[model samples]
Target: MFSYRHAFHAGNHADVLKHTILVHVLDYFNRKDAPYWVIDTHAGAGIYDLRSEWATKRGEFADGLDRLLAAQAMPDAIERYLQAVQHFNPDGVANFYPGSPWLALQAMRGRDRLRLFEMHPTEIEVLRDNLKREAAGTQRQVAVYQADGFNGLKSQLPPAPRRGIVLIDPSYEDKRDYRHTVQALSEGLKRFATGCFIVWYPLVQRREVADLQRALTRLATPWLHATLSVSKPAATGLGLHGSGMFVVNPPWTLHDALATTLPWLKATLAQDDRANFTLARHGD
Candidate 1:
């Protein structure tokens, strides 16, 4: 039983980092005239209401997107993400937030295709309604499923699309999720070696996170790993204070974009003194 509801954490520090990179990737794909497909493994509700009870309980976004939104002279990459967020909350009230599906839909050209998978029944219903409401009168194709994202990878890979992007953003609600990420990503690379793959993971303790990185590096895949830590070590050492994104077959321009955006993220989102960034290529 999957009980991870993204509503509570939508637009948090991790979401900021993941969605920023995602937007840049989509932008790169849009530069080409050829059509491309995007597979969103673990796609949550297409949109989120920041004013809802879930969002207001802890108000996680208050420390994430809120900081980004308040910054001046933002980098272009961040500007694109913030602009998309603004589009969803036209009143400038920021009452709503767009998840991966909605963000991909905003960036997709008419020829592009999107495949979204969500396992939660209630979230899936919200996802469908959100997509229908936002994509009305448009021919841009979309396919959504209430199934396991890991299975969707095997079933939908190499999606009639020679070129594509597949995003794996699991809730990590279970400790088993970490191992599942490794296994699923291994299979995905075997099936779609050339497709761009983005995997997001949180950083709680340095040792555990390092082990995860070493495991991914052992895959011997050509990939780039970028990390942004938002706080100092916790006294209890039990909460997420930082996060990272692993990109397989990243676009040539992504490294440069990260160089510019990550420093700013650290400055804006850090909750304590331990904030930093790392950009490295794996299996090069």
Candidate 2:
């Protein structure tokens, strides 16, 4: 479990898709005057250095965010998401990438709160240091814990504000993560039925991956599901070809926002003719 590190995949196509939707959701929450809580399960290092050894080892961003930065005619939501990314690269250089934790903090107001959980030993420490350096005076509003988010999420549900956004994204290195994710979401809803839930999963050639997607869609809640395929699945089936985000209790505007953004993402991030996207929602 500790073996999975997001630095290797930060700013990749999946991150682009995941974080783009995240920015829109956070923005939607901000529209209301009531303060809300942002709960990040499986929070990785809060921020990643694109120039660091880990990020450069894969250079995943070269085809992911880098492509978007150089592209033209971005849709409204995509443009907003890039602006959030730019907040970290203040020098106008894409040297740094903020993970979900940092992005949540960046978009949150002082009245809002952030709760983060990371299971990786080293990652927890790095998350703490990054939060302290980049988000001074946020200690009172942010809480970090070195524990399994899947199990720890229940205790934080129905947060004090009674309005919250829960992000459940695990590395899925352990095959059981699929089951755990379903179980966690089911239990979480029991505690906070109206809370927004966002789940991110990789599009690999595994049966469990497909199974997980199907399971989430069958939850019988209002949801918006969007997928982006950037390349053909490798013959060896060893890497991610794309990713998807399933949002429960999604904002009414989410589907339309993604409908416009997914196609642009497909064209910008595609590595071959096989690239494509999917958008489906079950709500008014």
Please name the candidate that would achieve the greatest lDDT relative to the true structure: 2
In candidate 1, the residue pairs with backbone N, CA or C atoms under 3 Å apart (3 or more residues apart, or in different chains) clash, namely none
lDDT of 1: 0.87
Candidate 2 per-residue lDDT over residues 1-284, each given as its tens digit:
57999999999999999999999999999999999999999999999999999999999999998998998679999899999999998899999999998899988898999999998999898888888888899999999988889999999988999999999999999999999999999999999999999999989989999899879889888988999999999999889999989999999989889888898899899899999999988865
Angstrom error at residue 221, model 1: 2.9
Query: What is the clash tally of candidate 1?
Result: 0
* lDDT tens digits by residue: candidate 1, 181-209: 88888898888899999999998764656
For each candidate, what is the lDDT? 0.87, 0.92
TM-score of 2: 0.98
Location of the lowest summed lDDT over 10 successive residues in candidate 1: 131-140
* Prediction-by-prediction clash tally: 0, 0
Clashing pairs in 2: none
The alpha-carbon deviation from the true structure for residue 206 of candidate 2, after best TM-score superposition, in angstroms, is: 0.9
